[model samples]
Target: MGTTTMLVQCNCFDDVDVHANSVIGWQQTYDQLGAGHAHTTLKHLTAERFQIFRETFDKRIVQIGAAPAGRLCLAMPVCSSEPSVFQGKPLTGESVTVLHGGQEFFVQSPGGIDLLCVAVDIASLETFASREFSSADLCQLSRITRLDLEPAMIHRMRKHLERLIDNALVGEALSEAELEEQVLEFMLVLLDSALEWSVGRSANSTVSTYLVKQSQELALANQDEPPSVLDLCKHLNVSRSTLQRSFLSVTGLRPVEYLRALRLNIARRRLRSTETEQLTVARVASDLGFSHLGHFSGAYRTLFGETPSQTPRAR
Candidate 1:
């Protein structure tokens, strides 16, 4: 869908999960896996059929989500504290990941990762591709998972994305049609690069991700009364050690720690919602299976750097 004018949104977040949901046109969640107060930023530009965004995570995080349907997402990390893993593949500065519409992806960051991403509607992209490219060429383009690029190429693309974001923020000289045209041109250059470079393909199997996703599904199904690590181990039919390793490998947190942190994150969200009439710290904590207000408050403060009582008012 094309709008007459562009939409620019820039926001900062203290909660990783909140930051995850701020990304325009994506279904994603960010789980904090490192220490310290969470400080994240999301800068987005939406125009016509294409969107561009820059996300910065200051702490270690496990990002689980999918790009919007009917679009192709191209992303590369602007910088990272360590090599971030995307779908089990390490994304170096020279490597770019291509995610097709509605494909679930996992990212594990050591800490401090800045990502630059672009999503273009697939139908519009194909219309442009059909002009000069063969059907087989388009097919190959759709199947690419990653592309290794030279430093100069990465720099060029980064600059283009940053410029678009800047122009959107400042209400710069570019008109709506001009912005759309620039986006289409950028997509063309990106597709051409995808064809020119050696494509990095995924493996036939992703057992680690399967286990993690299964566990997450199980855990979320009972989030109101979140199961313990032991309960999850029993339900998944995996030993405690195996489950622990799986959680640690896929997410940076241990099994028990991930569950607890997730519950805390959800609790924060509930407390922050204005829809929850007559909300209280005690009620929110109790509903999330936190029996002891004192202990819950301690854990909440440790993770979010604020007390539960402050959450509702912060909104």
Candidate 2:
């Protein structure tokens, strides 16, 4: 007799750091790019050898991380305010990012990005591929960083994965072994679709990913003394206009807006921390380069809808 014991979990998180840690068997860090309350939802179904999950976020988020070592992971956007960028390529319904075990990846979503992801053990995936594909096909699959599926194929895959989770949640009489077999078959079908269907080209990113990443790092590192747009342009060796356009394209925020948000978020974190004794709004604001306490409080309230003094109390 076949039996299945799949675990289903639905969780809501208010903090990006805590949300990143909620995923099983992955190392991920989520940075909130837009201000205001951050709310996220993750619904996952985990079986013996594979997992599928849907992630939804309310704020603009930049997710950086690696999947579990020894698993082949696939992720695609289901819905978003705008197409999310995956390693500098726009991720859409017809586009999927493929990562082998331990491959590092990054994705930036403007806001309200809904993504469905799947990860399966390498051995199980190899077994499935071996049966349905030639050796060359397997080799090519291993080399694929991204796969552009036919539109219908992407839709089918999404619906199939959703149905599997829905079935398991409804206490359908599907055995664990049976579910595993079905999931492996689904992966095989996806591979076959990739091979047989006419692949479409995904939209290219509007800005250079390196420029955005380096700019973000520089901004965060200088939170105590936020750099001006001129400084960023000079450091990047790009014209001010180019720098402005790049930040706007990638982050949906102008350079100044994004940098200010980063500093304010850091200050909010510090203010909310119970670990720091005698912490004050003035101290937090000053440490983050806020020279005027009144201005800092006003900006903080505008962004997060609460006064700086209330942050620690609420936390």
Candidate 3:
């Protein structure tokens, strides 16, 4: 039988219950604060060798658990600002988290998470690794910590995923085998690259990056009432200069600017949502912490090249 692909979109926390029947068989529980709505887009590609899923969730605290499906799963959080706890350790945006199918692990994301998850059947992946090196070395892969991947590499991975999604949606049998082979090759390449980065990483750099990620998570979790720079510094137990430096190094934007951008994006999404079509531009601005409507509109226009009112509501 040829591979099967499915795309699913959910608009609220209650809507995610249907995902239990997915190939990965995830059991999820979510806690949503305020009147904010949640949105999710899930694309699943399943073939003989492996299954890959592109999942995105907006504005929800979710806990996910799944039983062993005899696969080795690798998850890359693509635009995740908040730190997710996997197996009790906080995972930042810089690493790809791996999970052995037999070993159950928990994932908790505060919100705004985009993940690319690839699950290769254990037997198939073992056979592929045997050709690469000693089969005994495959055991070490299970113990591997989060693997570092550069931003450029992640961007390219996303582009590849988009192509795969497009191809899957087209439902052409002629290129199905070729597309599967490409996806397998890409997964192998990612594994190889991750192995290389796992060997030698500096302690100092890791700590700095973790701090920056924490700051980001804090800022994102409190979007409705963002903290000031001094508040952040105090909460993180770091000096203002240290916080600023960390934000610059990690996100290339100051803390305030990053928070502003995040709020603006949230407003934009709400404006475009069909469920929130009744929300006016002024309400969105005030709810997102913009006291001056004019300033909010100007900033929104500068960032998105259109005023908030210009954004069309989703039908």
Candidate 4:
């Protein structure tokens, strides 16, 4: 059996402010990129169908914001110059945030490289997928969720969102039932994703997660240090057998391999996003604790599918 749900979409830039008072629950979600003032394009997204409420062509929105239905939220930003929490984090995961909550995505609208964001709502989803999975499972699955960006999933979801935007742009119409189906699929994907995450978490033993997480922290903290397997046992007080099992179970890599991957992943990011940084094959290999240069190149090439010197770097 599956839970039933529906979605209401609005025309491009349709203003939902007038009904702000009527719609008991609305979140004022808008962004001017650190601007504290209000933008004209704020939208009040709700579960109710939009066609019923909006009769005019959408041009009213100078800004758009969506809050959960039956819940009210105000759109505002507090200025802070602090670097983003994700500043040093690798661009491996597909990031998602809520419409009206403690975290709201801020983007430069009408299309900008730095401001294009993909928005998804988990609550709006419902479907029976791979039995029931737990929150921990989802968190685990979410681990690879970012690491291995599911291109197929991304393509499907992107198209769906594109259609919604297109429909909004052209004011396209759909049957009442069809509209519901769209929302259903949207929610199903959401749940499916969560379920995938759950399965990932539960796939490994509790001990594995702890060791992997700890090892990851240590690796990041001492990227230059060669924290050998013996060091791991000394710090964590676990035998080689336990450490090997945990590493193999969660990340499927030995400590050396894991460190190599981590180093390359970091170096790759620095190459792509940071200012002029020389990560020559030998330099990178040595930094990652690979004593032999030849082996490092082979591993790096195999892992990233690119030669060390060929990495695209930007200042």
Candidate 5:
């Protein structure tokens, strides 16, 4: 299947009894199951973003007042005492990971547990934000800025999320360039606020936060030549197994898988979406780490169910 990417959504797991876990890639989010993360005991009264994100990026219509719903918040990956596998086998720990969608949340359950989640599609978000800020700031914004929020922060968050809703409903209210700024600023505001709320949810919560930040930094640091599992641990100060477990719990992709998948996803999207001008499939694949076009094409076809071609428009 194509990498299942839900740009902006708020759906729950099937049965509504399962835990909120990792997001599938931007192309095939719903087709594949979310990455398996630790479970939580918190009860979510609502999980709007999960459902909304899936449809948002696909040119779907926005329902009225969804922005002002007061629940269209960011999400963080929260794990409970559930069985989760990373790399291969099972290990024990109530670990969480930095989810691209938003802050991790958990609430104590008196009887039944509720898990509410919200995450924005990174691209849709950048599309929206360019209206208000620069692309560079948007990069900073995507990092899930950690902070503590007071009542003031909460109010700010509500306002920003609402603006996104308004803009989403009316496409290009601003120029495309402007949309990037707006989306990045919005992401920055939400992530900063989420950190405030996460202060005491679990001890060493920041460990997960730091790991996520550093992990991504390292992952991209050498995109020309990414590191091995052992290399990542040596550089990041985590065990290979610990890092492996951490990555699996959140991304549903192993370290190598994460890098490869990222490369393939980028190549695929460019091949399909950016045909406004002629593009070289080979160039894109190489930029994303494909040394062998034949091998890469085979993998791309399997992942996207279509061959990379100079074909005009998708059906």
Candidate 6:
């Protein structure tokens, strides 16, 4: 595939939208806090090569959903005292963090934060592995958990990417393809040399509790139009059986049942909140993915001990 690239520099948060859009197949949401203006610059070097972004924002939180099932992201902070968290784990500025596609994660950054992030499509990495190393299975990149990259290695990689960006800015179109190849090659080598290998949980040994939590988070994030179970399975890279077991074990309800309850709760909140005064029960129910108003009313009553109509409307 030819390299698809974009370069953006701006002082507004809206301009950062291109970074997420350029990822080929992913969805992201950003919430900025405080009162200061933000500045961002992002560049996509190639379709498979890593994209680089540096931003300075007034305290902000970001939520990312990697819907496309074959990519991995690595992030390292360049300047910031506070660390970012991913899936409940803390990521210090000095170390490298990896996240898999088909998952939901968050990053919290304070004002004046500077971060360096790289995302590589798994297919590209695996293709290189099979042809050059003859160890495609060893790549196990997705299943591997986040690792801490050495400070020296992180600095070197950052500098290298910076140089590439600088070179590209000078209108060096001829070397774009070659630079893409070199970046991917270097990343593969770095992963092999700098990180220890471990076989992650098998399907049987997988903890359904964590999976259930992840599903709930995804569902809540999309409460207005929650995804079907099959969609959830695909985004989570898990089997239907696993998701079922997880939901059952964690919430004492099947996945579908839990989703119904979640929708009902959301509806209740909307009905009670002043912001939704103009919304009717039927409208709220339908908005939350309920097709039949009667069924939705019954489910809502059973779960909340009151019919949707009985819920207090905003005054």
The lDDT per prediction is 0.76, 0.76, 0.65, 0.44, 0.42, 0.63
Top of the candidates by lDDT: 1
lDDT, residue 202, candidate 3? 28
What TM-score would you give candidate 6 relative to the actual structure? 0.51
Off by over 4 Å in 2: 1-5, 197-315
> What TM-score quantifies how close candidate 3 is to the native fold?
0.53
Candidate with the larger lDDT of 2 and 3: 2
| N/CA/C clash count, model 1 | 0
Q: List the residue pairs that clash in candidate 3.
A: none
Please, what are the lDDT tens digits per residue for candidate 4 over residues 94-200? Answer: 43222322232232222211111232233322112112334564455333222223556554654564465445445453433444445444443444463454323
TM-score for each predicted model, relative to the true structure: 0.60, 0.59, 0.53, 0.33, 0.31, 0.51
lDDT tens readout by residue for model 6, 68-171: 45666676676666766655676664567777767676776644456666666667666554432324435555466565666787788878766666656666
> For each candidate, how many residue pairs have backbone atoms clashing (under 3 Å)?
0, 2, 0, 18, 54, 0
TM-score between model 2 and native: 0.59
lDDT of 1 by residue, 1-315 (tens): 334456898899999988887676788888999999999998898776788889998899999998788888888889888989999999888888989999999999997899999888788667656543558887888788887777788889889889889766876525554455556656766676666623432212365577678877877788656665545655766544456567777787976678778889988887777445567778878787776687789899999998887675544
What is the alpha-carbon lDDT of model 6 when measured against the actual structure? 0.63
Question: In candidate 5, what are the lDDT values of residues 47-129, reduced to their tens digit?
Answer: 22222121111111111111222122342222223333321222122221123433332222212212223343455444334
Task: List, residue by residue over 87-153, the lDDT tens digit for candidate 3.
Answer: 6777666677777765666667766677777766677555445444334546667677566777678
Off by over 4 Å in 4: 1-204, 274-281
Which ten-residue region of model 2 has the weakest summed lDDT?
Answer: 197-206
lDDT of 2 by residue, 171-192 (tens): 6524565566556656766776
Q: lDDT (0-100) at residue 178 of candidate 2?
A: 50
For every candidate in turn, the CA RMSD to the true structure comes to 22.2, 22.4, 18.4, 18.5, 19.7, 20.5
